[model samples]
Target: MAWSEADAARNRELWTQTNADYTAGSAPAAWAREEMGWGIWQLPESQLRVFEGIDLEGLAVVELGCGTAYFSAWLAKRGAHPVGVDVTPAQLETARAMQEQFRLEFPLLEANAEETGLPDQSFDLALSEYGASIWCDPYRWIPEAARLLRPGGHLVFLRNSTLVILCSEDEVPAVERLVNPQFGMHRFEWPDGGVEFHLAHGEWIRLLREHGFEVEALHELQAPQDAQTHEAYDYVTADWGRKWPAEEIWRARKR
Candidate 1:
């Protein structure tokens, strides 16, 4: 389904409340502080090593749906000039707080990821860790990301797998069985007033190609048997995730 302004507004409210709730809670533990992961699964970039060969020194990077801008802060610490954009003001407020806490400086803009209004070819890398690519329509953001990146620039993002989406339902806590059809599943509306986006694997590839991107790699992240359960994602039980792909990371280059 095509993304609408209504969907955007709803998602902004959902994330705003989510950030506020999380902030009101206790501080993160040492494990969370050290891992610096992407999502509820908390897959560490240190282990995936997707950015191994890429040089971030003095490079320009843009992070879409940059909730608390933690990854953007990480990029800044590594010498990259990073800009974080999010649709929700509350999230940006938290991001600003994090910036102060980390003693890092970077621009954090409140804007929709599908239409960032950033300068053309302004960034060397576009990143989203279970962010815009999950919340915004790919057809819209894929082209926007293409416009934001210089030639040969890369776009790397992690999102939930189609299998997980099909098996899970709104407000439910576990991946029981395939509750939705595998084909023609695009937009999902949650009971908590949030919206999510997805596409079949082939559709994603075609959309990326249509938007002037070269598919480089696709990583299917599986949950280890020893994976610790996260309170935020009780639906993705370790056993269920081990049996099926829980997340996928896409690496595409702007051509």
Candidate 2:
């Protein structure tokens, strides 16, 4: 059900510890670097196709709520001056180590988006893939992103659509209920432990406008027919994946 004070406290503690581990050399949880084909960098290849064509050379970029800084590193490799920010020191530490291991250099900041204190219009672009956009409240973040960018700067993001997540179940009945009756995202709690939230299609679009972003494009990841699937398929699929335009690859500009 609902998040408890104890649960939030424990999550905060774990998040802190995890970030520390990241900074100290332990890999961030989501990246799964040890896995054979599932490295976090796989993002820019497919989910972020738009970035494939952009010239990032020498641009000042920030990876907000960057978990392991993989995206930041990737941007740096493309000649962008990428800076990564996250709430967990451990994760930043892991990012630092990764930077050293790869002979890459970029800055990392430990701060929350709601109060980053980074200079206004400091960055030319902001990139976040499955990190800050999904877990944190965008109601506060839209302005923070706007504040971080110049008047014409861009924000690129990827997030699971509410519909894709709800229809992930194999049963036709459940899928029908999600698509027809409910037609929205559901807050789910894991059996092992932990609670997560999701946003609906209209809600996402509304939040962007509320924060003053001029929406450029929003659509699905559009997996190929022969694309590989994650093991979690048995549990849930992102609503955006069902077509019907669920989850999104979003690009917006500060007006």
Candidate 3:
């Protein structure tokens, strides 16, 4: 189904409230962390090295579904010209606040990642840590990312692994065995009126190719031994993650 403005508004409303709750949680530390972390487990980029070999200096980076935009702040510190885009006003507000707290300044736009209406071929890199990767439909946002990037520009995003999705039902923690079919997985409706999208591995590869992106890597992420499960992200236990991939990062270069 197409992601309509109403759907975007609902997601915005959902995250606006969620962002308020994050103020009392780990969100603050995430913004100010010495190193970049990915996903619920906050796996260190130092070990994963997702962005290594790619120079960030002076690159025009656009972060789709940027939420609080901590990643953008990191990119800015590394000398990239970063712009954060999100549909949730509350999230963008917090992002703005962080820019001040860190004494860093970058553009933050209140816009949907699926169709940002930004200029074509305007960015050298498109990033979505957990933002558009889960919240926006890949069919929509992947194309938008391609259109936003200059030729050979990169796109990187992180999302829940398909294993976690197949092993769990709505709001329940993931189990050891598959609970859902793999073939027709895409749009998922949660009990809290939240809609998330997940694609099979093959499907993601195909979609990225369809959008003029050459698949560079798919890093199925394993939780470190010392990784702790937080109450906010009770979907998958740390043990389960260590045995099976809980999150993944996809890297692609626009053709």
How many residue pairs clash per model? Answer: 0, 18, 0
| Candidate No. with top TM-score | 3
152-249: candidate 3 lDDT, tens digit per residue:
89999989999899998777789999999999999888888778899999999989988889998888988888988867888898889989998999
List the candidates ranked by TM-score, beginning with the highest. 3, 1, 2
- List, residue by residue over 51-117, the lDDT tens digit for candidate 1: 8678989989999998887778778877999999999898788777766666778999989999999
Task: Tell me each candidate's TM-score.
Answer: 0.92, 0.74, 0.96
Candidate 1 accuracy as lDDT: 0.82
Better of 2 and 3 by lDDT: 3
Stretch of 10 with least lDDT, candidate 3:
22-31
TM-score of 1: 0.92
lDDT against true structure, model 2: 0.62
Q: How far is 108's C-alpha from truth in model 3 (Å)? A: 0.6
lDDT per residue as tens, model 2, 111-184: 76545789999998887776566545565566788889887788987766555566544342124345422445
Ranking by lDDT: 3, 1, 2
